[model samples]
Target: MRRMLTVCAAVAVAGTVVAAPAMAVAGGEAAGSGAAPWMVTVAFKGDEPLVQRESCGGALIAPDRVATAAHCLDHVDPTHLEVHVGGGTLSEDPGKVVPIKGWSVEPGFRLIPSPVDPQDFEKSSAADDVAVIKLARSVFGVPTLPVARTAPAPGSTVDLFGHGLTQAPDPKNPAAALGDQLKHAQLKVLDDGACAAGLASPGLLDGKSVLCTQGAATVCPGDSGGPLVQNGRLVGIVSFGGETAGKQCGEPTVDGFADAAVARSFLTQPRPPLAPMAAADPVITGTKAAGDTLTCEAPKWTIKPEKTEYAWYYNKVDPANGFEFYLPVEGATTPTLKVTDELAGHKLNCGITASTAGGTILQYSDVF
Candidate 1:
């Protein structure tokens, strides 16, 4: 579930050396600092001080939907991972843990090879370094941010946050203790035109999804699933850094996918124009069906059902006024919806919207 690219492979692109300037950064405090309220600290299995620690820069994509890198939760239980939203401290209670019901990692991204010799085909790189987390309960009371489905163009200014950046260096084994810094840095977007140079020159970039510029402050290992906010919208997820295998942050290397092409409508479900989407399956040839007696159904293809809201529209416009929903209702379910007043050829539109408990999401689907 994490971005996997051996240090050696990153130097070669289609077997060609990357021809860019080496990225360097002195490890201390790199980019973001202070208590990032929106920074989510994720832990697994309730281990001592928490088994493993990873900082996922989440923006409360939905009250129940958190977008992070798949690798952040690799080998960790989705249901058991404790999510501390809007805070810097870790959650103490096990019940506060949000169980992840479902998620889809970049289909081809994998670290453990499918076979042996396993080169680029099955590897996890920047190509698909992004993923999302679906929580059992909605993250209410917090304000979720917005996502930019597309990457920011090169030279775009961005901001990032995380729960890691500093650790007491391991003196006995210098390499062991010299981990990543949790904050600080200035970044700009690089062009995808030079992928060979991009990959060859070092820094945390892959040939697949993004192109980042690591400067004074760069993202480190624990910061893997964090968000890269730009122009007030989340444009990318921090996936890698350029520090040498044995070394820590130094030089000016940028993280990968500065301008990630995120899906604008990635969090939405499908809406339908008519209800009873295959009510009697067979349709019974021709009978004056009574709409009132039929059962109503949920929307079809609810992509991020956990982050959606539902409403039935009689025609192409508004059903009523008063309440406009952003969060989802508890009642509806599945591919079928019954018509309140069945008509031979009347058009009924259903509005299915995907949203975060904080009120952010992929997009709203309209059916009629």
Candidate 2:
């Protein structure tokens, strides 16, 4: 239940930031470059291709998209953000480094208290800490990891990857022990409900959006945003972890992960590069009667559209506001729509969306 802020090597007290007392990856061993080729470091812009300023860890979901914890993006200047790829250790020679083009934090993300006071640890929990980072260009060579559509079942074993301290750093010089090489460990998924209940913080590990896990191997500072892989697919992002009874690093503890399954839509939703402009509005043709089929003609676009999507909507008068508003017809997406009895007295309209490398644009047809 320790609300361990795994990303920063410091904790925030009241309104001030202070150095952390400990940060280490106990029971973790060195990870080979092949062990996690898709792994990357969310680091600051530096002179070297692979900088040692590891802020957090992340995995490439697509050539140009990385999945990480939203907290890693907090308060950090976007200009200083960049991704380091193809290196097993931070000091390794030449690797591809890409600047961050953009990023999206999943909605409803909450920041958990760092180094939560033992008395308040059980009550300190956060939600939706996942984020997707857009790289300036696609990374080549390294295979991207696919995101799991669901969380692994309890008792399932998973792999964790990160570049964090392997042992507790000397309090006098914490950064001296910061690990230079990537490390990994095996962990077991725990019953989220039972885990949360033990910590007296059910909302922290709800089993829906947050997953509960534990093992002899524990994540430490610089591990936040790292991937939790189950069956070669990413299932969670390192969110938070803490030892039992306020013990220091390396002790047994339960960790909470931002479930990738719950954030699949946010992670996989298309981000079109540009929008296609319609030369003309869409046109609907057909008899306006029940049982009659209607067709929507798409307008020409400035550029060839890669894809055209269609949708149908019906208008109904609101009794309270006396205003007519459009509601989408369930499961309607084809260019042709059926005028079913369900919409006998309603005014109907169809719309077409044109998607291209330039962008995505939508145009509505005349009411029918």
Q: What lDDT does the true structure give each of the candidates?
A: 0.43, 0.69
Tens digit of lDDT per residue, candidate 2, span 143-175? 999999988999989888877554445666555
Tens digits of per-residue lDDT for model 1, 1-368:
24211111122122111211212223223333333434455554444553134445454666777666655644332333566665433323212345544443444333432122234332224445555566657766666667776677677666666544332223453333222233433466677655335443333234455556544455544566776677657777666554322223332344564234543344332211110111111111122244532223333432333454444333333358654333222243432344433332444333434432222222223323
TM-score against native, each model: 0.53, 0.63
How does model 2 score by TM-score? Answer: 0.63
RMSD (CA, Å), each prediction? 16.9, 14.9
| Candidate 1 deviant stretches above 4 angstroms | 1-35, 50-52, 55-57, 74-76, 89-97, 108-124, 167-184, 194-198, 201-208, 243-247, 258-260, 267-368
